[model samples]
Target: MLLPWLVTCLAGCAVILSPVSEGCGPGRGYGKRRSPRKLAPLAYKQFSPNVAEKTLGASGRYEGKITRNSERFKELTPNYNTDIIFKDEENTGADRMMTQRCKDKLNSLAISVMNLWQGVRLRVTEGWDEDGHHSEESLHYEGRAVDITTSDRDRNKYAMLARLAVEAGFDWVYYESKAHVHCSVKSENSVATNSGGCFPGGAWVTLEDGGQKLIRDVCPGERILASSEIDGSGELIYSEVLTFLDRDPATWKQFFTIRTESGASVSLTAAHLLFVSKGNCSGGEEAAFGSMRTIYASDAQPGQCLLTTVTGELVGQNEEGRKGVGRLSRISQVNMREDVGVYAPLTRHGTLVVNGVVTSCYAVVDEHNLAHWAFAPLRLLHHWTGSAGGHVGDTGVHWYSKVLYWIGSLLLGSEHFHPWGLADPWR
Candidate 1:
């Protein structure tokens, strides 16, 4: 009877000690918690396109991504900085063919150098598998070296360029007697050589097809005279005698023409004419004319004609001499009377004046000169006239007005004086 009474009391205690669900609070014995704090939106600084690119640092790397012996070396397309340019040297000519590895390394060198010199562009005069005259063991043959031209023709500038190239991480920097700066990267254990300040002899190897190439300095005041034969099909059969007169390449432009002394004339593409220091034949290899064909047209204006540059979309002025011309599309304008070369207002320096001034001026830039892309038009405008305020960047003007300003700046040549100046504030 005592045992039964004790068990009944224990059961009653268990019920009374059990925990209460509601009295434990909202979060299992914890107080109410607050929601997560909100974060403020980030503020970013605005920058112009050029500054933005520069701030991002080098667009390429110095390391050769493609190994020297790898098959990919031939197929690789290396990413290169836009500021670097490739040029043909006066004596050595230009060689752009390079392994993918060397191209990246070159772009890296260009970026590092540009960091030190503002508005400076690197011109790679030579690269990759040049003639055997350089040396069988030369890094250039292996696509590990390049020849860079100095910013200015001054020897002091060349020295500065060499010093900066060394600072830019080039393993070998050679100031080649004011001609060009030679830079290379070699293996740590491999010995690298530079010419120092001494002038080297027999540095250039004769190009394999140098004999067959027609070398002409395409420039202003240059004339071409050609005589052609025709077949029964009325198509130009071949050119019998083609004569090319030499002119300074510095004066070269986009389109050029050749007229025979016998009143017969043919038009020639100025872009096809290669500017060389010296050579034998001076004409483009015509497709069906057995290396020389002359197209005859009565519309061919007889007289000394000017040539213009055509590469990519930009047609007028290319002082940098970067890419080769695509084709001679059409003769835009011509002046048969005036022997004097005139400037199409706001056009590039060498643009020959024909019939009359070109009504429009277009601003342009190539891959090498992209650093100036933003200011290309401004520079072209500044080359001649004073800045007119209402013309280019006026915030108060209508958006359509601004568009007209750019179009007018690009097309119609400048007039005597336009009321385009900005108003003085609080005047």
Candidate 2:
């Protein structure tokens, strides 16, 4: 009798909350069809098509339009090397133009390929083509898509190229063909402000002062607890924060939550890297350190061991409080979340402790240490120029960043600096 009464009450509540109903019955309500309650009309002026046509012209489009002449569009030239080629440069060669964001990502993709592989050149097969080859709603029409391939012609190289393209910050990367990797960047209005792997705002970062702070509250010039070595030496160090990236939550997407067996968990972007052990067990400091590798949050799986620090005083104090001892904690779960703002504080050592878990400040690259070394020049420029505090979204690649890219290009022609040489031979 009690169960029946509860069920009837729930049914009545459901009917009341529902937007529409089939018909009213004797027991339910009245024995007649009832219309939904109409909402009060808003006090907005009604739109008139004739007025819109008069103001916007007979074409029914606004006069202020974004076109090739818009500032958001840029003309790209393959000035890096003969390795970077444009498809059909002689014909249909008006200009290789794309959105500014797309152009920047394309440049990054080309530079990454040149830096990652030896004797490999990237060929831009398509850019901003409106020759009826793509769908009407394609990003190509908006100058935000490009199709590329490598000179090597290896299918394996193409797959790696796609991965690199993703790392280079393309919004969407697809291996459209064995020969080409299709990459596209989201429009400025549709994309998030953050450019790289980042942690959600709630993640805790250890400070150099032996205190913990939210990652979003960290700022440039602040020192944070970091580690230079992965081998279980139990040696922890303090590294200066170079930049703090706080992403806008409105357009930000792609997040994953990694929960360890020890109850340590952190939510971060998919591309963010976390130190994970190769085996299932913790083999103490020596064995665990050697077996640990950086894995992206998107690729992390259950049962994988992640490197973390235990809360008691194991190592002696260095200016700060007691040092944390490194330990391997097996992962219990990896899940995706939709609502969270992202933040990342890039430290000098390229490693930071978040929510008691040891993770890399760098993303997309498996070799965290090597990636930090490769970007040393950029970090140095930021330090020297004091431009690290600039917001990624608002500024869209600060002037100092552009200057560094230009310097790298000039130094590359002279054969003075080679990033490929920095890769670890053992790995």
Candidate 3:
């Protein structure tokens, strides 16, 4: 996929790229505050994977085809997203399994290299394999690294590739004695990085109807064996499966990579699979706060909150065809900072329609413009006293306020005391 002398040309074409902001998103806080550094903007637009398309079974995000009873050497979420081409012939018995995070960094490098040399293909020689050949301390065993061959025995090309990989968020990149570019990733989150990714190769079953029935043994042809990273509750965070593979007992036992709905490919072992069917007519699973709707009663009086029900689906209808519903609880206002006392009095009080119940609630608009309406039936004494400002005057009569002042001083340090804002009265 390349004409000769590509390394010499690329050797001088280096760009000092800056770290991309992964955390500190618009609504999120700035990560480990430091002086801002000037970033050299990329020449070509950096590639971004289509997460939605990947989740719905897009092709080519992987390196190879996905079908039943066929061998796939390499694969990504969708077909066209790959920038580097691997020399599968070199990786005879090497392991290819890796965490999704690792694969993403690799793909990012491929994108960078491809953009740098506009049509050249990268050939990967080795990836994760448990053949007892890799070192005991190797990140390859955990599926966090890969080795790629440079053009026609060019050692400097290997060094250049290592430099490029490090710029793409890979924590470690080294040229091995065996002549391949090795790169590894230390996860941003410590726990996930330290812990081994999703369960390794095994047999599993899906629980149905509260363990009343269990579906076991996915037969071939219909069995799209899947691997997914699940949360503590075991809900799908991402999911991928090998569609085209020689499902012979010998071949299927080995770990195959899968692309989640998010389009990120990850190595998952079949050992931890446990799907639970919700039964017919159960409407499958509903995401959290899925049915809740927030209507701004900025104009409505506190007791007689008027709901301008637009699009009809968000709010409910009553015996009389009116647009508004009565409040289920007392309307509360979300307050401001400790030193500052800005208020959203009119904008705060509102009635929320959640799962067909009209409740008095306060709406909190997030960075993305989505409103979070909270509803609670109970009200306590702390609700009236909670504030970012604690009146801690030594002569104050309010014991609750004094207690809060002391608590804030103790926890936040008295010198720079600022009480955490109370989002809701319940908290």
Candidate 4:
């Protein structure tokens, strides 16, 4: 009886010390334990290789065709007030890719048109065509052309759009039909319709005979004042006029008027080159003229010095009278002019003085001598066959010029030859 009673007391003590019973006891110090939370499995859709091949072709890669169903075919949002819409459905996905430069200019053209006519939208009908829709030599094949149309399709509206395209820096712009306006940027593989640099009518050119003639009246075989030296020295020389080019008035829509502090001013196209000081220096004439460089008329800035000339009477019988002396004049203003006709005359030295300002007949190349050397072929062709050279009222660029430009591209390599500006990366 004693052994059984002892065993029962020991069992009761063991039960009091047990962890499961102590945790279960109500409100002693522990609370009821919570169960672990269960998590649901992630849902995933199965990959379909057939769907991928159907969208991206059997190669499973983009074949340069922007389909209407593709996410790549979307509206371009420019920083301007207008939106450029590419209607891929209209072309039925036949259009290929377009250059970024072309797209940028297209946006600019849209903004310009919208500013003129409020709420106007520019719709791109064709970007690049691989369906043999355009001419064999069309820039569209090179991804440099775009066909645009608005909702109105009015003739007047298209005319305005063409003008705006020119102003927006398109190398070529045409009103193809009542349907669309065609615009293109310059490409390495294509020939440009117009040479880059040209001047306007009413500009004055100093003759070798100490007299000045209107640039429009100046003809081939005439001698004009030019300088071979890059520095702003008054060492004037004469160079024979090789070809006089009168561009189509409709080709140009903008001109820049560069006015100097000495009350001298000249109006010229944006691509025309002029001798400007190295930087914006407020030094004296001698200091400013010490280092001269060539820059575009559109790039000219006020307070910068320009190479000019001052006419003075002959001091001796051996010297010619009314000779121009090189002087540096600070630019007062650079304004845009829209009322001017385009004229560009190629000279033997590739440099000329116009309206008392030292300018270059050749553009694209900053160095006057190098530019003259590069165009040697065109000049030689003109000398041999006068027909291939420039003529009055001839708007098309000569075949020789196109050949020379192509050769230049070959020599300069593809990476450095920018057809749009003819800019040399090395310079």
Which candidate number maximizes TM-score? 4
lDDT of 4 by residue, 101-143 (tens): 5666777878877877787777777876655576655656545
Give the local distance difference test score of model 4: 0.57
Clashes of 1: 10
- Looking at model 4, which ten-residue stretch has the lowest summed lDDT? 53-62
Clashing pairs in 1: 224-258, 253-307, 253-308, 253-309, 254-307, 254-308, 254-309, 255-308, 360-411, 361-410
Candidate 4 is scored at a TM of 0.51
Q: Which regions of candidate 3 deviate over 4 angstroms? A: 1-82, 89-95, 151-153, 187-189, 192-427
- Better model by lDDT, 1 or 3? 1
The predicted structure with the larger lDDT, 1 or 4, is: 4
lDDT of each candidate versus the true structure:
0.31, 0.57, 0.29, 0.57
Per candidate, the number of residue pairs that clash is 10, 0, 22, 0
The candidates, ranked best first by TM-score, are 4, 2, 3, 1
Model 2's lDDT to the true fold? 0.57
Please give the distance, in angstroms, between residue 203's alpha carbon in candidate 2 and its true position after superposition.
1.3
Comparing candidate 1 with candidate 2, which one achieves the higher TM-score? 2
Misplaced by over 4 Å in model 4 are 1-195, 228-232, 249-251, 279-290, 313-322, 378-388, 391-395, 413-427
Candidate 2 is scored at a TM of 0.50
